[model samples]
Target: MTKNISKEIPKEKRFLIMVILLTGVFFTLLNETLLNLAIPVLVNEMDAAPSTVQWVVTGYMLIMGVFIPVSSLMIQWFTTRQLFIGSLVLFSVGSLVSGLAAALPYLFIGRFFQAMGTALLLPLMMHTLLMLYPAKKRGTVMGFIGLVIMVAPAIGPPLSGVILDFLNWRWLFFMMLPLIFLVLISSIFVLDNVTTVTRPKIDIRSILFSIFGFGGIVFGLSFAGDESVSWLNPSVYISLCVGLVCLSGFVWRQLKSVTPMLEMRTFRHPMFSLAALLLFIGMMTQFSTIILLPFLFENALGVSTVAAGLILLPGAIINGAISPFIGRIFDKFGPKILVIPGMILLVIGLQLFIKVNTATSILMFILLYTLVMIAIAMIIMPAQTNGLNQLPAKYYSHGTAIFNTLQQIAGATGIAFYVTMMSVGQNLYPSTSGIIGGAGRYSRCRDTVCF
Candidate 1:
């Protein structure tokens, strides 16, 4: 969309700039789920229930949902250097807070800061990268980012697995502080202003609506996913209703505002809308697997945290390795070339997962998970690049923000739905089969299944 933009900037300088964004992205994305491996450990060490401890992961995502929409406005209001440096600093502070945390609530405080940092950085990277490269090259660059998205979590779990194996759970955050600081320092030399600052008027009411709107929805979804909470529970229905109501108000506020925080009209483009919907579905399924596999391995299949963490490594690595090439293909071809087969591949993988059980071989699990991950790598970035390509250049920031905002919410929603579905199903049967038994119930409970 940035047709005839500044290719005048030295290619090497651009490369350095991209490296900074990617490294930050890798760290943020890693922290997003690095704790999956640490969950069991945190549960025991922190003296928290499994459900409560899980929020460390879910809260990070939900918080991202709250802030990402505002990033589009921030992109216009601040210099790229200011946003990047500030976000990394906040994330570092969060990591230090988390590493020093002595209690679960303290971890939430730290994670809040961490999530805020990530929420800003993720969209900023995409928006900045788009400003750096034109449409012709986006596929390959976004593909590289796909490598980070696919590989960071792949690496995070096993890496954290080893850390948890040898060190305290707090080391997870402590380990990230150095990486954050390195990126922070690197950004000082390379980060520059890319977009023009309009210094748009801040809509105070819309901000509140977004906070409560997205927050309420994430909260309701979290509650809905808990097996212990009945559908009729006041917490469940009331939260969901309030969330819906606030979200509706938020949408109205956006549509009515001339200078909306998030320009709701980006959906006017059919391709962007379609792309957003598909991206949401893809992230949900991918995250569901990302979160669930560790649970199945360590809890259901009786694997070690280390082994559970390592299980997903191979396929994800392969996906990371090939993603760039896949991007090249997208550059030459187009979205349908990737999206069609990727969707079919994903559906097939999900079908196979339905039959998975405690006895399923680790290699088999890896193979199936790889199928899903590759499908995701194929679909996620290319589809997003393709969708953004369709939009007017002015809407690029809003499009990136929307893409990221939906992505975070989708991760939270997907995790909540699938996790609760499995728990609900497993509790119904009360078997040693764990997620497999849940899958079985899911198959029969057609109206309420996620397998």
Candidate 2:
């Protein structure tokens, strides 16, 4: 049966499947960051505080983090087509709910639904890609996936800025509705089941541990930067401690269980472990820059929101455009050559920001930012593909799920850590001159702290 199915799937059909999957994945990811600029608008319109309104973003991240661990199990239980179509439908409904939301609570609920769909979509796409392509060809294919990952978030702020220039916050969701519905409908006809489904018994305890474990950590880290939430507060410490304990239990349960929720044994491979570490660090740095750059542009350099977005746009575009080529290089030469140089470039790019001051040129900023993007383009996809390549076919879904979940956690933690550092620096310095005198302090602090 597997042989027949493989023979029946022509190259064109495979390409079409990729197109459909990438379309769904792209829009879902695009929606993830689209609402960032709209937060202020939502806060004012809904008469909610910044922290309360932030649940729109936080809720999505939380749900995604919580659900990602189970995605490995879900893939085992469901057909690819079934999961793909269901995720798209769920995403469409969530978008509709958010677009038509009458209050803050409705928006949060909608965002939660959106997140559920996204959690499935991300790992599903990667798992499908791994199934369709061989390891040798994976670098090139994953590079395109890298394009989606890198470009979507990068363009999100600018895209939102442009949309809000003429339209309101709700239109953000409304505009996505048609595209999502179109993709959802198309996928129904073209998508086919790739992974063989095995009916595994759902472990209820594992589910609870996963929810509290992952959810608690992400929630605590996300709220760590809030002025109202102190590091010394019980809520913060309690959540982190509970998260750690539950996650430990979850790990122990997985090791003993007949069918683990996620295959922890993937880490037994040295290459996979190293790749995961590199991916984690890369995600942390990428997210920190995403959070920090806009503030530096607008607050310190006096650039407009639109201008800041514009400044970041070109670098993202170039980075995304070149990703496929980088993937080809990875396929031909392998990761060692690409990753080492990429890391060097990455460190150099970060170092450039260490001495940023009032006199730093926007042109220089653009160049350095583009360099960072380029370095990330070279590293992220190749490292991820190489890591998964080390795993056996049976572990594909679990491997992808584990890697993605950690990526999300890293992103949330990075944002929380960097924001807190920035806030503390602001409080300690209290004036623009004070900040400038210690202009290199922010980057130095981040280096010492995060690295």
Candidate 3:
């Protein structure tokens, strides 16, 4: 049960390996959210519409979603060193191409390559961590992974604001270039293959199903409410329908496959299933808040972009900084103690947002938002660790891939739902004057119209 295969590896070697892996993961995650604030800048500079510029972000996510299922297969086929180095190379090259891109096409292509790398790297890192650490120690290591996940996105908007204040948008990629190169170089020296590779016969049909399934669903949801694409568009519905059908086929095939691409048996464990459900719900709230808060700050309250980013900075920092301690707590006490209170706090924090208005104090917003961040820190890592712990060592790759893929889907769903809600809310007001008459009126009337 203790999968202590890493006992042969020296403690220093293990530490160094983890350091390199963490460094790579940190930057990859940072790159994921880095371009969010720069979308408007790209629109003006590249002469692209908002909808078109959004594909840069959406395309990246789409590729990640599509390719993530294959990662379980890839980890099984390749050594840890091979996948890690390959991911870094792909990410580095993509960053360079994006940084040098003179047109929107080149930028999109570069993002695609970046997504490929991220898809591989995410699962590879998690699987490697599970291999390196024993079950008892995984909570602490995963907490650090949680820190990377929380902190990178937190830094993205503010970092973008500071960069755009002086430099061109390309610096977003360029600034990361050297750090990436350093990690790539160090990884060559430090990283080792921990998992035994078994070359499973590649199922072309399953691969196609995965691509269409995840890709179609994500693409449809991502553009669901775009100005150029109506939610009621036949193409959107077609895509979702195709995605759902293919995804069903993919699951069925996995359940029946002699050597499944992604092990479906992980769900048989009650605790694992429950943990996944909690993580999915938690992600919906986390991603929705992340997308909605900037709109409220910048558009509703007339706060500057820089000020908006700064306002959220403290809470993000606090969220990440406390993750390690939360992980330790999860180790001592089981997940229920941490996750239940965390869920309650998350609900309370979200409910508090119902009262936010033009007159709401910035300090109050920060406090409530920080409380939500704390809840996320408490839930995300603990839940994920607990779920994966329920799996046998052989299923680590599949479990991590499924967990990450679901998280991506959940985030996309959250963003789409919240943005659509905001749009519908604004439309209900009927005029600019009505929207501006009173923030409280707009808030109350948006969801339920005033007679």
Candidate 4:
């Protein structure tokens, strides 16, 4: 979309700039899903129940959903340096707190703080990059940023697995401290202070509407599977119902607001909205894979924790390694070439997942999983590039915030759905062999029904 972008950059300075921006994105994206593998370990170590463990993931999503709508306001209020440094500080504090946390509630609080910080990094990095790069190269610049965001989470699970196996669950949070410090130090020198009030005012009512509306939907989706077990649960219905109602109100309020937190009008641009939708889908499947992988390893495949983690490491590394190259492709070929294939590859990867079983070979499993990661790398950056290109320059920051917010929400939805489906299936088919035996069909199912 940035048809006339430039190719000129001093190699040394280019690398430095990229490092600064990528460092920020790496942490943001890592935080998005790094805990995927750690969730199981947390449950085992903390002696927590499934319902309680779900909150570790859900709470992070809740905080992210509630606070993300206000990022535009924060950007408008604070200087770029302040925002960047502030986000790192907040996120780092959260990491430390989570690392030392002895209870689930404290960990949730830590995650909440962590989400607050992560929510800002995405928008600020984009804004910072746009400031540094000339307009001609904005797409190229953002493509790289997108690459960082995409690649980090791709590898996080395997990395988390390895860490959890060798060290402890707390390392996941502790690991981030150094990265946060590096980004903080980098921002001190590399970041520029450029805050302007010309954008829009922070309307309290609009912010509240969006936060509650989005938060409610996320809350409901988070519990949809677990709640389905009890049809008469008022809280379940209340969460879903209130979430829908509030979201509707949020839409109405945004339309009426003179200075809205989100720029809903941008959706009038078809390309922008479609790209956002693709991003939603991309995030949905990506997280679905993330949620399902551990189960495949633990329950279905019977792989040890370390071995399963090792199996995943190659794919993660490859995806992370390939992201920068994918960014460059966006510069050369545009997004359409990359996105369609990426989506197809993603579907192929997920399809491979459907075949997994306890008897499946490890190498084959790794190969299929690696293909999925490749698909993820291919689609994610291109989709981001396409979405950003859809907006005008003035709205880019808010647009990025909105896109990332949708991505986070979509991921939350995907995890919820995947978990819910698994829970439902496990319940519905409990002791399939026994059911077959009772039905006098045990002979028919001896070979095919157990798996």
Lowest-sum lDDT 10-residue window in model 3 = 442-451
Residue-by-residue lDDT tens digits, candidate 3, 11-109? 889889888988898998889888988999999989998988988887887899899989999999999899999998999889999999999999998
Candidate 2: where are CA atoms >4 Å away? 1-8, 432-451
Error of 3 at 95 (Å): 0.7
Model 3: how far is 185 from its true place, Å? Answer: 0.9
Better of 1 and 3 by lDDT: 3
Error of 1 at 5 (Å): 3.8
Q: Where in model 1 is the C-alpha error above 4 Å?
A: 1-4, 43-45, 354-359, 432-450
- Preferred candidate (TM-score higher): 2 or 3: 3
Two-way lDDT contest, 1 vs 4, winner: 1
What lDDT does candidate 4 reach at residue 387? 70
Residue 20: error of model 3 in Å? 0.9
Quality of model 2 by C-alpha lDDT? 0.84
Cα lDDT of candidate 1 equals 0.82
lDDT at residue 33 of model 3 (Cα atoms) = 82
lDDT of 2 by residue, 172-275 (tens): 99998889888988888888888879868899999999999999898888778564567777877888899999999999999999888888999999989998
